[model samples]
Target: MASAAATSVMGSVIGKLAAMLTEKYKLAKDVERGIRFLQEELRSMDAVLQMLAEKDDDQIDPRAKDWRSKDGGIAEEIRELKNLVSEQSERGKRYYDINQCLTASAQPVLLDPRAPALFQEASDLVGIDAPREEIIRLLKCEEKQHKVVSIYGIGGQGKTTLAMEVYHKITEAFDCRAFVSVSQTPDMKRLLRDILSQISKSDFDQSQMLETVEQLIRTVKECLKDKRIITTTRKKAVANKCCTGIAAQMYEAKPLSDEDSQRLFFTRLFFSGDDCHPDLRKVSDDILKKCCGLPLAIISIAGLLANRSKTVEVWSNVLTSISAAVEKDSPIDKMKRILLLSYFDLPHHLKSCLLYLSVFPEDYSIDCRQLILLWVAEGLIPGQDRESMEQLGRSYLNELINRSLVQPTKVGADGTTVKQCRVHDVILEFIVSKAVEDKLCYHMEW
Candidate 1:
């Protein structure tokens, strides 16, 4: 009996030992898996830390610190970790949304079906109050049968607005229509790509410049073979006009008419929707004469007047400042110096590009594609070490347009492409004078 009892005890003890060994092995595996998961999570956190460091340098507040500070129990800690992930995801989404909004807003014109027209007859186009018959006559004279008629002028002188007005008026007569703003320095390849992309409504490899250009020209020729096209530029080159099959007729868009100037001045001075001040009108007429009908000058003077007390004395003071500036040299020269104040405010890279524009001839309508290519060639745009040169160039162009230093003359029908650009004659002349002053260009005597 004693022997049998001892055997049973030994069996029980062996079974217990086996169970303990299995349990210990299972625990070890669970611990190993947990360690691996924690290691992966730590690596993810390290990546987030690196991103946070970059954001900190940019002056953005880091949210990781807040997450680290949250207190939780064992189960709560796991939940909090999940919440942290969700929070980071939300933050990334917000950042993307903000970036997109900024990009959309920074563009000169964002084309949307719901967006308002470029010109609000009363609010946008200054000096457009002339008799409808006279205005239509001028536009009709600008019309061409088989060629593209480009109206060139200084920036902010209503070139695009005028073109928009004409486009809205005459688009019905053509089979197809396109409006493009060529704001960047002229590049044949980029221009072709833009034309093709807009026409086809598809993305393309812009790096394939030659192929893109050929494709664009072929597409444009095919599509607009019978359509009347209007393009604009700020670079004085006959080459751009000849690229497409259409013959190009150039129109030097003069400044606003004197009557239009007077209207613009008064509108700016007494913008409170009140009755007109005849005295202010008289003063504004004098200011208009000083403006020499340049819409940009008129607008600038008007902007100055709008910020001050609406009194003849204030207008007189503004006129005196302008007159003093004018007495220094030609109105165009004075305008350049005045406009330089705005240029001085640009970032360094943009300043270089703006100055580089002086290489082109006076009253030249610039092709955006060619301009960007030239910038890339000049090393004005940084390469992949930063943003790609093309992106930087485009950003520079956008900045100039936003500052009203460069104006869009033609926007492609697709609404995203800028076909041509024209600096205001006043601004162009200013650029030329600056170039001469800096000895960047020489005037050769024949």
Candidate 2:
């Protein structure tokens, strides 16, 4: 009987202790005593149950069973403890508004999808408004020319995004417009039919789709007399085909400046350029620096850091992970896709040349002549004696530049020859990753 009473008391004490632990409730000396008592009583009751379980069935009959192990009891101690616990729970429930508790307790807030994002703030953060406006202005010009403009940049540098912005801004002025991806190895008939149908707002049947390439080209020429269409591609070779009459004017999408890079790093993370947490400032800055102002890199890394606690130790580990990723070819998933597309598009010879160049440290400018000599020495330059090895190497460099994979650092006065070139840091990381994946090279840490 005494032991059963103790179990009831312990149950009540545990309930009260749980209430006290809630921040909204007060913890008094009596509450502490109740918790301690509850723990001790639980230990004793556990031993009792264990003993009962082990004892012979004859020794542990219904009469020997206590109230805890029995069906029911209304003894004063049991009844009183139950009442106390019920009353305490009712009081706690009155004070605990779930919504209020959640709002007050959460740290490092999350975005609510119900609210619309500030897109102008984004355009401002990434500093794309000027270029976007310029593209729009050029597209809307009243010149008699075809006015086809091709926007170019390394992968993940927001070429498509900037072009989309311009496309939207000026599409209404054209007779009809459609934006479509002309992926590598597009079927010319289908490709031209899609462009013609979209620009003229006509849907072609299967029979119409069988029209000759010359007929499709004529349709494009006729529709584009005053109307305009925009297409994006990874290579200038592809862009030239999109233009039927004159070559398209090329607008290069430059990487963000340092100031814009910082703003973009913070904007995507916190949705505001301001409001960086104090503890995260240094680590956030470090992460942004590694991004090399590439939109995809900055945005992907920011998404990762935002979910994590803003502690130096945690962020430092992420920094180390990014460094290891560069060595192991395991960059963030978004960056991997962008870079892999560019790397795969290269010809076999260019692929070897690009991967070999990855051996240079990030951001090191390669003199065209010297890089050509190195390629020639390694027998990487492709030829059947059609051109000298050095000339072939420079031709490879020029081709890569036109494809926007290799950025020319120093151009001759005529802008025809690239004297020096350098890979963007993001591309360098990707090339290193490819090299590691293919077992072509492995990085060593000092």
Candidate 3:
């Protein structure tokens, strides 16, 4: 039985190799040579193994038995060949890695949905009057001192839009001003040089590369010692770090209010909320509730619905698909991609901890102690001892909160530590989808 199984496996592998050589796949010369060598070796082994399987034990020669034995023979040769294949594979990966490194060093194209909104006309924006005023008030541009305002919030909540709006409004007050968007994996030298180019006059040559980030920062600061700046980010640490040694204000961007959400949703689909059809109003409100006032989500879904039939059946089906975490559609998939920017930025362990929140129902206030214990049991949180594990788990939780991916519902008596938290429904849906898609966790609905 063992010899027959080995013969069958070898034959199957040889067939695959034969197919590969005949297929349209473009193979490198070395790889094609290796595949031919493996094909011949495997074909020979398959024939020998088949003959050995057909023969009785007494009829088999001792040499053939030796070849089948584990000590050294055909099995040993196969093992050595496997090791050789692995080594070649590793070499190929290393070659690709070098090319990837070169690609990484080049300027990355910005594909972020929010990046273009920085240049959007203020007239095209909705629900900005209040937050815009608040941020501008925090800036206190009238003061002689250079002030920095950092706006932060959950992804898709319009932090970038608000900052850009305020920047345009008060930019004239300062002689030298620049609006730069920092990415998750920022190129510091390029970023600093960008700032310098924006604020510096024509004397600033964009062609000359700066030697170092620190030198660029000194040059930028020297150029803008009296300039006011507005910054926006999702991570609180980033906000705080950028505001260091400067008079700074941290403004958390708020979701559009219900009225504004309706306005935005309808304005994208129709002339205004008043123009919404009677049949679509209820479904629109339902969709808005699921959106949770997220401007990007609202606009995306509304834009999708605008192109399709505006019937209750179609709209309701869309909402139902969202509830079911169905990403087969384009708009929802795009929104998931956009909102998952925060999730993609997380470290591996924090990502696991964040996805585990999908186990809870949406808007469920999770107890910190219970969540930490579960995380430890699931091997999501790593540490040596129970106390240390729990401590580490809490830190992971705090990091997620700091990134604006999770929300704190209850705090400890010290008023600093988060004791309970909840994941927003919009975020939870994507987390559940991601968790299931990656096979990291099984999501079972009750």
Candidate 4:
């Protein structure tokens, strides 16, 4: 009995020691990983600081460079020491959290060819090109003060596209310019930051919305007193409020004219280098009329046509099919119906993300960072085992933006930057209505 008790005690002691060693091994590995990640991040930060220093050479004298170099060397040494301490103490939990926070805090970088190749290819395929002439005309009109040109039309009438085209055209003429989307569920702070950030060509902290707005307004008044500012809003009331002192001209974008519709249809259907079988126009025109000159409707129908034979009868039948699918309400309603078809076709997770976007008001432009943060906060995005919530949120937003439901309104002056998003008013209305219909959100009537 004495021998058995001694054996058991020895076994327990050995097990405890093994467990301690195993924990230490894990700590060591985590510390190593944390150190490597930290080192890489530090290197990137150093490169950025160096670039900034180079840009502000006059502010940083020759002596400052030597000081900076020494400072960087000290930082590296400190990091190494911290890594050692992390390995020895608390099983690297602190280091893991630090690494996580670092990753979460980093802003998303928008890489070029930012959207999916399929979207770019689709844009190229249909030649649903921007109208430069109309854009220039709008810009020139915006240069004249007291000119309120309302591009008024029902939803899906391409108002946002026309507005964007005008914005890009006139951007060079303005010293400072801002574009904001005021949706049904307006987040004024985010809208302000997005506009201010665009004009300043920098990342304005969303938390500093009031300060950013004040600075932005001051900059606009001083530098672009005569420059044009363009904003889109679904609510006339909201637009009226925001545009009181800022917008020089408000052009309400209308649906395409019958002639424009026919032209757009022909361009989409037959303008491809391939020859259209003469019957294409007869069928294309019928599809175009069924779309009621709404760009989205036209485009959706055209997309359907692009996949099939380009006969007039086939085109007419396509229109009949679309009409059968859509309920009669307004041109905007038809457009929504068409857009819904596309939305329904999306995978489950993407559908959830897209609907979550309805929380913003019409024409409300969303910063990519802000959108991702909101998604994370809402718990709509899934947490990754290895990646931070922010990273996962970014990936989700990028996926939605790529699908073309979200339009990129502004890209920063930095060649590589996150693009601000704006859903078309028609799209926003559809989302909001869907949200209300499903009792997912309460609509506040103004």
Highest-scoring model, lDDT? 3
Q: Give stretches of model 3 more than 4 Å off.
A: 1-120, 202-210, 326-446
lDDT of 1 at 67: 39
The better candidate by TM-score, 1 or 2, is: 2
Query: Cα lDDT for residue 134, model 4?
Result: 49
State the displacement of the C-alpha of residue 184, model 3, in Å, after optimal TM-score superposition: 1.7
Q: What is candidate 1's TM-score against the reference? A: 0.45
Per-residue lDDT of model 3, residues 1-446, tens digit only: 66654664565556656655653433556878989998997887777787877878789789877666532345545555555655655566676667557635644222222222222458767899889999878877665877788887777787866877788898776676777766444677777777767777552584255577677777777776666677777778888987898888888778789999998777766656777789898888878876777776776566446546889998898787665653443443546754554466577988888888878864567998899899999989654469867877777776666444665656656555666777755678788889999898796533
Could you give the C-alpha RMSD of every candidate to the true structure, in order shown? 19.2, 22.1, 18.0, 19.4
Over the stretch 206-252, how does candidate 4's per-residue lDDT look in tens digits?
33544555665554455444545555544466556645654434445
Between candidates 2 and 4, the TM-score winner: 4
Model 1, 292-352: lDDT tens digits are: 7766766556544543577889778767766766765655665654476455556787777
Q: lDDT of all predictions, in order shown? A: 0.56, 0.63, 0.69, 0.57
Q: TM-score rank, highest first?
A: 3, 4, 2, 1
TM-score of 4: 0.47
| lDDT, residue 132, candidate 3 | 91
Least accurate 10 contiguous residues by lDDT in model 2: 109-118
Q: Taking the tens digit of each residue's C-alpha lDDT, what string does model 2 give over 219-313? A: 66666675554656556676666664664566777777788887767765666656777887887777666666677676546545555576789
